[model samples]
Target: MTQPEPLPSAAATPAPAEPPSRPSLPSLPGLPDLPDSHVDAVELSGPRFQTEPAQVYRELRQRHGPVAPVLLHGGVPAWLVLGYREVLQVTQDAALFSRDSSLWRLWSAIPEDWPLRPLIGEKQESILFTVGEVHRKRADAVNEALFGIDPFALRDRSERIADTLIDGFCERGSSDLIAEYARLLPALVLAYFFGFSDSEADEVTHSINDMMDGAETAVESQAAFYTACRELVAAKREHPGADATSRLISRSPTGSEEEIVQDLMVMFAAAHQPTAEWIGNTLRLMLTDERFALSLSGGRRSVGWAMNEVLWEDTPSQNVAGRWPTRDTVLGGQRLHAGDLLVLGFAAANTDPQVRPDPAVSTQGNSAFLSFGHGEHGCPMTGRESAETIARAGIEALLDRLPDVDLAVPAQDLLWRPSPWMRGLSALPVRFTPGPRTLG
Candidate 1:
């Protein structure tokens, strides 16, 4: 992958803070450099990442300051940047800390069957991996396609989909929001946005849910998604419509069908998983936390508050696949050699005591949280708005339909999905009064 150039808008945006000046551990004289070994490296996974990650990040900060040496899947050495300032610095300076993962030093040692490879290794041609002028064009094309979506129409589509999904289980008086609603709504709406027919939308929803679940069917589900994307692009090319797929195909600079397909897959995965998690996490917070109790009665104000709070406290994107140093440098008092992977610890940074002194206070209107990320590589504004629209609309629709809904299981019994990278519920079982169905 080519190295990422600074965003074209860099000149207008304020400069990021300089890298922290704290000195790292001094290399002993006459010792050969160890590229892939760190004596104090902590494992970035296990029960702690799922259940008590905030506490774990806090402990890591105490042990290793802002940037801590950590082991990724398969004991791959990396740095987890946990400070707000450090994360900002790393994300902002894309030139120094490049987005190209090909720079990673341990690829020669990384097994072909490594689980994380599908995410970070494969799909190198996608927009997520592209940089420089090429990346800018692709990013612009994507934003333009998404921006063309009318907000009111998007909201209506979301509402209609939410109603249709709710209709299936509304009479049953109980449903697992994670499996049934939260996971499916975004995929269905996105399918519609990309010009999938009703049947294709259903297929997409099923496949995306399976793919994200990391189940035995994940590989097959991924293949199905790619096949569907190729078919969709082909259909769009032969007969363009007022849809995102058509817009993307028409505007893409390369005009390469494969490039467009890869980008669509990237967009689909990125848009669906996080938006689903956002809805689930926000609903979980509102249902469990007293602060959001009023929102249950269809209070629009508190719905927005609950959603904003989730972005700060339990962002769906907990950590992000990160930047690699172009050259040896010190960051947050830790030595980073060229090719060292640095995971952007968004969840940890949000809770950093320097910026957020009191976690108990409300973050209702604050937009500084790195939940949507920061700098040139941050989640694009159109992407953020579309996700927010989908999430807020989904939550509001559920509340409007089931005003008296309550958690079917005890608050303690509601388990989170055991993944290190995302913060979302495994199941949000809720029961409500069975009422006559109405099309929303």
Candidate 2:
């Protein structure tokens, strides 16, 4: 059996080279002047962020045209590659662009020896963390695991859990979607995969959120989260249950208990966190777009398309996959040193106009979007039957039970989680009509 062709290298590829002397951040060419149309000024920080990103995205396209360099949080310099082709180039070329977070050490306050450094190692980093052959091999392994799970069984279990939560909330009339429903739903699914009891799952979910909160104080909180994950893995091994944890522990090449625990922790972090945000964002999008919500409720054939549209429009992950510059390279016309951090802004890339001519359309072909990322380090977990099954099941369950659910509070009244790396509402209060009861 022959191996596949290796992904392109960042250094070897021919392109306009960055001059020997590093140039100052180049001015974005072809940007249009800010529009004179009467429109509400939307701030991109604080409470405004939830509503502002899409508007800013549209405004940037209108004012600066596509491919403008926008100032992100803390005024970090980042090129917003809004052109579809440009964004795809950045996303698809692993050699020219990197996803290693360590490259941005100077920009972040975290210490150099942070434990996360090992988790996202020089090679087998998270699915979104590496490039080249090393990235390809690891990605294949993770994808196999992710997709190997039975989707129907997973969805059946998820539906039961979602129904149970909805039943509990329906009696109470109004519920905080984030704390009561959305948070618990993903955590339960994750726990089930880890072979954890419902109670243990809830605890781990809370702990994960706490650790994320302490990311600025990451060393301590991450240590705590890892400790919990290790304990769970140990228990799963002893019990030998039918969940992902047991499977991974039994099959992992790194059979050491500690190594198994570390792998599980990495998977847990990647799977649960962003999923929670996706659920919350989906709810928020439904609230804001009544027509879209109506489409879902009215049984319009476009629910799948609408879901994709929502995913693209409100990307849950704010950080693009980070990569380390293996050698000197140039991206978006900016020269990067060998060790520079290259962030492929997935959110910015997803909204790029060149690839997605109409941001409103949900059914655009797969190659145009970056919600799941691209290239060797791109999210290999995507297109896995298991994830698709889960998504289909979750969406179906949501449509069946709470089709018309909308935010109980005004859009501005909602609270967003503060982590720039993740975008999920901290609490989404919503009102919905109760679904018919199901007997156990």
Candidate 3:
């Protein structure tokens, strides 16, 4: 693959070769007057993102090159890093492009009730918003907590969880796998690891699902999550255990309870929804694609292939809110000013024509996809492994129990959730043979 041009340093002077002039950016309603640099900036929402994001990214690349200017919710201006190389440049260089949301320049203009505020996360001390050496320490704490988990034990517990969930609907022979299985398994397992009682886990799981889905209860759900985490931190402090929350507390002795709570929130928020979506999307692939369906009988390796293909083709984490430049810089030949927000386009980068010349090609055993991100802020290795173990075990257990499972609805009739930041099915209805209860 051809290498992308070297990015000009954020503090360095621009090269003598100037970009060619283009027509002024088309105006949108209620947008404040700004520099004319953003020509034909696209809104990150709407039907295009929900229905056809890959095509949307391709069109944006064709029109505006790799680093395209885009409008977020409530018309917040930001750049979407759409190229594989551009995303790498942004993610790899923490000094130039920081994950600190407090550096964002538009905070004063943003409304109090701005929906995207939770995601942009300005002034939050969570590990997600931490940078530099402090971030490394927090990340280390998270890694230790997650790494302490035994993969074999996790896989076995996940199998039991999957069986328990399937028990609810296994006798019916028809179910919405997204709601009944995929979405619940990760929450239950994570909750157990965090030491939440069954009742607390149920409540926290509902709040998490509501927040991740961007539902009407999102604000309340966000508050609920914090409250739950704070309580967990307080409880774990007095009586330490082998649970992840207790481990995090013991690991970060110097960190504040608030910071620890926030980091726990980050772990739960990061792991739960994406893992659930991975399970849902992988199941969708297996149910729809004949190549995978044929392998359902005895082909266990195909399960891994389907998981990897989903990461490449329909990553759950489509866009991340994102790296902010420390100073003016030129990336992918486009000028970006100081404090500008850059949404990491994971799905777009995975499909960039430069690396993936053929979309139809198999990506099995290729782990270069940026679905979990890259560099210092990438998903911790331990976290990724736990998610994979949970997902793979969930899928394998379901297949083992129901070998003849098939889609109850037409493939064309399936609908995707309308969230620009996430790509997942709204519901995956399927039919299978009714079996005897396993846990009884």
Best by lDDT: 3
- Please write out the lDDT profile of model 3 over residues 1-440, one tens digit for every residue: 22212222222233224342232333334557655666446567765577778877876776677888877765567899999999999899999999999999888777767778878997788999889989999999999999888888899889999999999999999999999999999998999888898889989999999888778888899899899999989999999888999989988847599889989998998999999999999999998998898767774759999999999999999999988999999998889999988999999999998999987888989989999999999999998999999999999988888888999989999999988898999999999989988998
TM-score of 2: 0.74
lDDT score, residue 167, model 1? 93
Candidates in descending lDDT order: 3, 1, 2
Order the candidates by TM-score, highest first: 3, 1, 2
How many residue pairs clash in all the candidates, one count each? 0, 12, 0
| Local distance difference test values of all predictions, in order | 0.84, 0.58, 0.86
Please give the distance, in angstroms, between residue 53's alpha carbon in candidate 2 and its true position after superposition.
1.6
The C-alpha TM-scores of every prediction are 0.91, 0.74, 0.92
Q: What are the candidates' C-alpha RMSDs?
A: 8.5, 10.7, 6.8
Task: Put down candidate 2 lDDT per residue, 1-440, tens digits, no spaces.
Answer: 22212212223234223321111222123322322221211112343344455544554445434444433332223444445455567666655556655455333433354333443354443445544665555555455556556776788888888777777777555778777766667667767766777777777777777766655655565676677778887887778777777777666654667656766776777777667677667766666766566756674344555556656766776645355555776555545456544444567667765666665554534434567665565555533344445545555676677767767888878777754356778788877776565644
| Candidate with better TM-score, 2 vs 3 | 3
Which residue pairs clash within candidate 1?
Answer: none
- What TM-score should be assigned to candidate 3? 0.92
Model with the higher lDDT, candidate 1 or 2: 1
